[model samples]
Target: MLSTKEHADVFRELLRKGDRLYLVPVPGHSSALPEQLAAIAKNISADLELVETYADVFAALEVAVEGEKKRAIVLCGSLYLIGHFLSSINN
Candidate 1:
């Protein structure tokens, strides 16, 4: 929805997390999001884990939440992305 790269900073702030995980989409699927979002995570700290699949994201979140570290998981995506993860869980 945006043509400029600088505007990503706003989302970057909103998306900041204790330890962020980026679910990078496959090539040609707005692939720029990986780098853009990762930059946001790096702006907060030196740690950023970029995983390529929904399962990896769920595993990471499970570990984080189970650790009792009070981490907030923010999922920002279209309904299709949400459905993909949901389907993964049901199978």
Candidate 2:
């Protein structure tokens, strides 16, 4: 539901506070953006994790939700990823 800028701002703020971020990558696609994000986080001294599967996504969300302090942001690469997440959530 958040715009990309809003998500980026949240990410920046989280990075500022030394929070861990997980960037879940869409399979079989270009990983340029995720890689760039990882590099940016590294530049700002933030921890970044790249996960690439449905199980990974579920696990990351479960951990973040259970942790209650940290947050996890899922960046869907294309319409396909967005649709998948949307459908899953709706169902």
Candidate 3:
């Protein structure tokens, strides 16, 4: 999810151990930087990866999928981030 660290902290209970989390920065917006979000994930001992672009996200997703096992991918946080993701995919 592309959100602030504070927001994640409040909803941190939703995170479980061993979850693979990829943190991406939302440039020029009021969101948690990747490093900031990574701190929270590290606190819970979650597997975390920081990526710079949507390309990196897709690359990570490709590696994350094991065989034919379907995995749920969630893209959340602010409407701005959602818009950014949608715009990226459309292009």
Candidate 4:
């Protein structure tokens, strides 16, 4: 899991590259509000996609990669989603 500062740093770097970023809010956590997240994206000039479920993240990444040929997926929200994806990839 990444610390808040690490996450922020990664987000900053990703934004500079203009990459499409998806943020899946962790269930039961509300510190990262949608509007705030969107505003952050807008501030950094990067596209932001909100994902409400783990499945949504997978589907979105698959569609973006297969349909749009995007090669990287930067998930910036929800440690649960991050663990899920990491476990899947490791397995």
Q: What is the C-alpha lDDT of each candidate?
A: 0.48, 0.50, 0.56, 0.52
Model 1 clashing residue pairs (backbone) = none
| Candidates sorted on TM-score, descending | 3, 4, 1, 2
> What lDDT is obtained when candidate 1 is compared to the true structure?
0.48
**What TM-score would each prediction reach against the true structure?**
0.47, 0.46, 0.61, 0.51
lDDT of 2 by residue, 1-91 (tens): 1123344444455654545555555434443355455555566654444322223345546755664664545454355557656677899
Report the C-alpha lDDT of model 1 over 1-91, residue by residue, as the tens digit.
1223453554555543344554443322333355554555566545445323333346545655665666566655434445556787899
Per model, how many backbone clashes are there? 0, 0, 0, 0
Best lDDT among the predictions, by candidate number: 3
lDDT string for model 4 (42-90, tens) is 6656344432222245665665566565466566556676777677779
Backbone steric clashes in candidate 1, count: 0
- Point out where model 1 deviates above 4 Å: 1-13, 16-21, 26-33, 40-56
Residue 6 miss distance in model 4 (angstroms): 8.7
Q: Pick the candidate with the highest TM-score.
A: 3
lDDT of 3 by residue, 1-91 (tens): 4454465564376556545666565645766666666666677654433222333345545655646366566655556766776787899
Candidate 3 global CA lDDT score: 0.56
